[model samples]
Target: MVNPRSSSSYRLRRSRFVVPPTIYRLALILLAFSVFLFLVSQRQIPVFDRGPSLPQKSSELEERLWDSASGYGYRPCVKPTHKYAGIQKSTGATDHMFSPIENPKSERSSATAKYFLCAFVLMSYTLYCRFSPIFNFLLASSHYICDMVAVARLMNATLIIPQLDKRSFWQDTSTFSDIFDESHFIKALENDVHIVSELPKEMESAPRVRKHFTSWSSASYYEGMSQMWKDYEVIHVPKSDSRLANNDLPVDIQRLRCRAMYYALRFSNPIESLGKKLVERLKSHGPYIALHLRYEKDMLAFTGCTYGLTDIEAGELKILRENTNHWKMKGINSTEQRLGGFCPLTPKEVGVFLHSMGYPSSTWIYIAAGDIYGGETYLSDLRSQFPNLVSKVHTESLATVEELKEFAKHATQTAAIDYIVSIESDVFIPSYTGNMARAVEGHRRFLGHRKTINPDRKGLVKLFDMLEKGELKEDTKFSSLVIDMHKHRQGAPRKRYGSLPGSKGRDRFRTEESFYENPFPECICPTDHH
Candidate 1:
């Protein structure tokens, strides 16, 4: 009913409210430019634009690891053809050097190189008891020692032999030599960092700096520590915790870690001989699956897993967890831990998983563990499926098991034997990916992509809940679900997955990356294949 001229005028005024085409285009362009600047500031755009290139190399080992055509991956099936039963008989220097120590010539050359480096830094593990309930020799000496060596090198400080913790639960006064090849360890790092036995007389009074307990520290954290060289004459790392940065280390420093752990840190001759013997015995049953059953009292107590335990056992583990001072997060609910799959797989669950995977009932499983919490009663379910379960504790020949008991007095020695057998086994499976499991998995990857079946814990727990509730049968449905769930986790040749989404700042390195635990895709390749 309005006048046409008035309506037309109103329409023209309304049209002016709409943004013009040129302004809209300009706004979008400004937004895009802001995003581009943000990406450039983050250093994300360049990383993507230039397709994945190998990290830079500084050592012979790094050179081998980064070789364009061959360093990245290998055929998993092609194992070393040579059959060597004993320590000496094992594949010699030409192959993947499994021998605890390199020869005297290599040691001497490394030592000579060490004599020309900077001032001395003496490191000692004096935090708690040396062999504390939480500390294992492999972790305390082998793993952290490598990190310390790398730290010493980065600081340009000559490393004195780190004093091993002697006063712990074991009570044995085991020195560095008692556990590791001390001479070889010192010599091995000669090229990378100078190592001395005792403090020089005049430099004994030099000021010492004890590092703070900053867990999974950053490279910047270490660089700041390196800056301390101007003020202090010597930097002494008094404790082992928070000793090394997670990533961003130089290629030589990382390679030095490899050298320190795999080659230099040799087990004592007797331990090596026994470990080799154990490997041979496990192999006597043909190919065996080494199961790292992390159901021991200490492990369960620490993790707060009580799925298969009796009321009494559960109460005890709960008390232990509460009492442990260093173990954070004490008020964990056992049911929640199990349902969320944060708990280690119970023996029964492990049995179900393996049976569902189509492993025959007669398959030999070597249980690498210290004394389990509930002992035979808890293991009965797994034993019912895999009756050929052998450990240092239980084996076919009771006499052989008895002989092993003598060496088993030293927990580290027994652990070494278990490690050697696990690494050389046909397959390795761990109920929980604890330190031992992580170390073994990494070593297996280094050997070649040896078959390691890591359980999809979170997914399996959901399926298990359905089965318990009678929603899903224990037949083909369960097997198919489990098999499909773990397809990607079967030790396949894949590049390392980066930090989890939303992980920022120090939190990015907070939870130790699996690749750092197992440096396969980075450090491992087939023999001469590269």
Candidate 2:
């Protein structure tokens, strides 16, 4: 090549030609015509030969959807019918509540402009001639939006929204917030299920939904609960407005029963199979202590042992000797197996520990341990080392699964909590989870069921002390439970509490020590604390 640089220069020089001005002008005209045509044919507001009335039955863009979804033959798009079915039973509460005027002024204004602009564009393009592709698309979209909005307005929906504050919802309360988060208003809509919005009052916090009413399909159930609350407000709206009274809608009696069940089953999911097992094996009796020792990964990944080790690990062999002292031989089958003394205990060991703690361990000691059967041998060995005092202990494995379903659920945090309160006569002395503690408090509040629970006071005291040090209220809500724990032991046993071994936490983690007594050591009682 003559010279690479020179050759490149020649190519650049040759490429510098410009189009003629006449040709440029023609191109601009063509572009403008295409844009103008597109805008005209898209979503144009029809220049109806008639006055500004609702667009008539056919030719008008709006009529296409009405025609399609109005009568029996309108099943193809599934949208308009969905909308119509939703608003069918409404008493106009939803329509007024969520009326366009209720939206923020800015949003309403913008939507109005957008609708007008789209209509203008359609009119501009279609006024001239056939713009088949554009016109068809615009018609389909209009049908979809209009049909959906119409359903929400008419309250003819097969479904009902109990929680969401459609523009018509009149009140605001904490209870309403709970209803909104806990309710299934959005999910029903997404699934194309039609529900009317009729519970317009703010006080109507709890919601109930009706599903697939048009098809006479099975009725939809409220997601969480259906209990008759002791303190609940029952609102019996008119049949026309209440999904509960919708005779045409299918009813789910099983769903009705589910809501009224004794315990909240949310805790029973990932732990369902296990929950069933516990349900089957559970023996209700006096109070029991639930000890959950988070182990394993805490040993390795926990930068430097987050929760800390018991004397079993800190002092090693020496603490193992200490653990040996408290090992109550369990007569009942315990899934007990120790990990290391200070480390996490095995599920069986946990069972054994509860057994050794007081009377019967088979009573519900809901634990959320990562490894239920993981460290069985170590725990059993410790139990074996001291067979006398511990031999009467009984522990039934409360949580065990081949594969974890819900990490938190399997943790048994909630169940461990309510386990104590549900046994109103009993108490739980758990070594972990104030969330479970708060949950117990909440469950008691909801159930209007209260129990005297004295959890591991030694440790709880330290925590509360820390809270106080940090300037936090000792008992955010359940502070009443905490008193001078040493004060009253009227019916409590003085002996058993003293002889019982302290927590496995040795020098690794310091805990206040107070040996509590067991009134009914052979059995279990709320008054007992070992």
Candidate 3:
């Protein structure tokens, strides 16, 4: 017979290796849960499948098609492609859809809902959050506002009207509605992106991610930024300037930027009325040139260019620069700055340049600028050359004068008035390449390539230096040199310049021409297309 002790040891070993029923039950539960999770994930994930064909109602198709292309994660709605479908009969629908003037309505009809539902189902897994960008820079720079709006679209987020930075250098407290027509901005851009006046009540106190996006960022950068929506309902951008790349953005995005800048961003009713009134008064006189002369105390202090200033004045600017907390670059070499063409031309230099430009003394010159740094001391020179120099302060209408006086301390409102006048002028000239200058130049391009003489500051500076040393004379030779130097610089249709030869990474974007400065091939189309 087998030994009893050995049999008992074998039974004990078998018992030690046996798995409990509870463990098997727990594993079955986990497997089932994992399978359920996989199903849920698949259902929620966005897929690139061709869904059912959209309905063929022309207006409905147009609305849905635009919405699909408007960062809504949907394949573009295709029109009937039969051999004799006569798509061209729509009369410039495809060609003009990208135009800033084109306002495509977002319909809420049943057909639109069906298409939207289809898109939503496909993109159910994608999360869209609300973006609230606080514009901490100059509100006068409309391009910054446009860039933020385009950023909102890129993020696929509902945009609450951006809050203006009242603490900026201007120190003027102006709300969004004070400078822009808020309702018009919202309503006009409804078809492209959702915009609300403020955050929802529930979301007002919710946790938000304050993001300072990388400067000159590409669209993919923002796509990656959207991942934060998983943890936060809102993304707050601290600063909005130069947040979008100048080039390499999608055509629709660039077109959206154009639409927002040109069509949607209308000035406030009071500002617009006053601005138009000033424009009318200006036009009544004759063709005038809007001269954006950026020679103010702040500009000088910020740039640290004390060229042409008296010793005492330069000292004052130096003190101001040192005292300003935000201005980082201190102790700038004024001589180097001037030689590098970073300084705004002095009033005398401007007068000399204009005189050389063939402009007669009788030509109307509207000065679009803040107070000259040295007041009449510096302005007398430019005035002596162009006797017809005028500003908003010189308007003849008492009512208009009183209205302007009401907006005296408000720099943005006043700047808006100047912008209107500048854009409508027969010719636009900027002595400095500031925000307003670039914006007006691009806008003039949009308005059928208007005459804008962007001064060659570097070349002109060299000439000015030569003239100062008595090596150059202010004769036809000088005039011809100036004219020829700017022959191709005037606002004309040309391809936007790309990055410099050796630029790499983000520097490439920084070096490229700003889209707002020249949105040529994207927003501006060829004549034959029309």
Candidate 4:
């Protein structure tokens, strides 16, 4: 209003000072590029560009496969190459040699993501007792410990090395480090969860909440549990078994379970060395069958299966069961237990089953068991059929005699040796589906689905009874029936079974197949997929 020319000059000056839209756009683009470069430099963002291409030659491909199989430059717990190629060929199991489809680099990143949040806040701690009194067997304890690792990861908390149970049935005072390679366990799971040898000095007196997580809890249950971090610096789990549900978990978490079980929980150096030595000795001979004959006095007493035992032996088993405070059901009917297929096969029945399966008398058999109920008295009939039957006590090499003697009294260590041999055997057979059998069968599946024969006890009991009553004979028809009955029982690549139909609530979890028994579609993938 004062002067048009002056106003126009002012406008022109203001326009010169103002930035153009194009320049603003260009500046924003540069700023975004700089931020992206910074993130790339810090590895906050993963580059997707194909860097070094994989070798295309057939020989190079073979080398690549071999390297993956052998787990070169990887952790010691990385799955080993299938060593029973001869057995695989004989059993037509060549199709199961594919490597796990997980991308290791991505897995590391995902595992890091799980705990990165805790790095920002006050670091929380998780301390758990690995061995519960109820499930204190070596393999059972191992499974529970693996579950504890998964729980620590789920809570985004650092896990203190778990305390083993010395007060359990075994009454062995083996510490965690005494049985497991503690350093290897820590290093292998470094990316997945923080594992310290013990609580930090500052956390020794920190306020902690002792929790006994409900068995077979879902992931959401653990997520709710992590909320405890706000009130307590440490969360101590009194028991660890079955804390994680069998199914309906994230793929990463399920895979983490596999990583913990298959790759982190390595046996101590002494145990592994002796176990491998025994395996080598057995492999030096022809192929052998590992028969996990669970006919020990303790098992018979616990199951109340005194069938085939003398009257005095039955009395002894009954008295032992009644005296055992932990074994709750003291008045179990032996006939009902046997009819329900809850009893382990007797040694004589094992002989008949194997002979019926067409295993010749000359076949090498390794009995993977502890002290039998009646020793050679009960085993005489089985030994008579399979003359090559042997056990760790009889198969010790000269160099390992003293070493074996050192582990003779420690049931856990001896069981570890049997576990190794059973997993490596040409065929694995369990007389009872106990913890060790489930663990071994699962491990064998992980190792390329090696042959594991799960005998149908319920089905076989009928045949056994008929033969005892002179109603049946061990003929070609019997062999065909035994073989045909087990056609689908062999370890095969399949998805884990879910809870039984109509199973609801927590009972459903109990009915579902054990994750340790079959980790498929999560840790395992078809060769066609990557």
**Ranking according to TM-score, highest score first:** 4, 3, 1, 2
Models ranked on lDDT: 4, 3, 1, 2
Q: What do the candidate models score in CA lDDT, each in turn?
A: 0.63, 0.29, 0.70, 0.74
Over the stretch 291-317, how does candidate 4's per-residue lDDT look in tens digits? 999999888999999989999999999
- Which one wins on lDDT? 4
Candidates 2 and 4 compared by lDDT, better number:
4
Question: lDDT tens digits, residues 367-450, model 2?
Answer: 333342225444454344333211001332443433222333212232322343232323333333232332343333233223
TM-score for each model: 0.72, 0.27, 0.74, 0.77
Model 4 poorest ten-residue lDDT run: 81-90
Candidate 1 regions off by >4 Å? 1-137, 170-172, 197-204, 218-224, 396-402, 405-408, 512-516, 525-530
In angstroms, how far off is 451's CA in candidate 1? 1.1
Candidate 3, residues 206-235: lDDT per residue as tens digits?
667777788888888886875775577677
Off by over 4 Å in 3: 1-141, 394-400
lDDT of 1 by residue, 1-530 (tens): 78999999989998889878999999999999999897676563222111122232234322221122332356332121232111121133211101212224477645533421212222221111122324445554567667766666544455677666556566545566656777887776555555666565666666666655476654456646655655666655656554555555544445566777777778777667766777777677766788988888878888788886789998998898888787897887888988888888888888888876656576678888877668888899889878888787676441275566556456666676778778778778899877788778766666566777899787888887887899987665677677677766756556555577888987776564653356643355455554
